[model samples]
Target: MVIAWEDGHRSSYSGESLRWACPCAECRGEAGSPGRLARVQSLEADELRVQNVALVGQYALQIAFESGHSTGLYTFGLLRSMCDCPECRARKSAT
Candidate 1:
């Protein structure tokens, strides 16, 4: 699945990563737990390359990064809301 940040940057992630990165408390945790990415720093452009993408049934996306980060499940809605591209900015501005 495609994971977009809040800075007009887009990256492809696997279904595994997608599910792992789920913001829902059920998947990650409540609010202070490690969740999927506990000590994971924001991904850099060089590391945004999608190594693999796996679909977990029809619920989540698992994304493996070239940097060996394969624990961030990205949901479809989350992916859409995470779109931080210029297009999104323009759309927001227009709105």
Candidate 2:
């Protein structure tokens, strides 16, 4: 999906990348536990497919995948940071 920011910047993301970056407690973990994505070696196609996306009260996005994992609330900041555009990549590398 592609998001156009209010500042006229555009960020794009693929389904697989978004799925891999899911920030739910189950996917990102809490406390000292490892997340499911970290333990899993690979993801199936269905797991990476974006089935639906919905806004969460102007703060985040609730994305559902075909694999039935839909717990991640991708906030605007999180999504923006996840952008892989050349500029963003360069900025991250510099930091």
lDDT of all the models against the reference? 0.59, 0.94
lDDT of 2 at 19: 95
Candidate 2 lDDT tens digits, 42-70:
99999999999999999999999999999
Q: For model 2, where is the 10-residue window of minimal lDDT?
A: 28-37
Q: Model 1 over residues 13-50: C-alpha lDDT tens digits? A: 45444433556454466656765345555545535567
Top candidate (TM-score): 2
Q: Each candidate's TM vs. the true structure?
A: 0.46, 0.94
**Which stretches of candidate 2 lie above 4 Å from their native place?**
none
Q: Model 1 — which ten-residue stretch has the worst lDDT?
A: 13-22
Backbone clashes in candidate 2 total 0
Error of 1 at 9 (Å): 17
Model 1 global lDDT (CA atoms, 0 to 1): 0.59
The regions of model 1 sitting more than 4 angstroms off are: 1-46, 85-87, 91-95
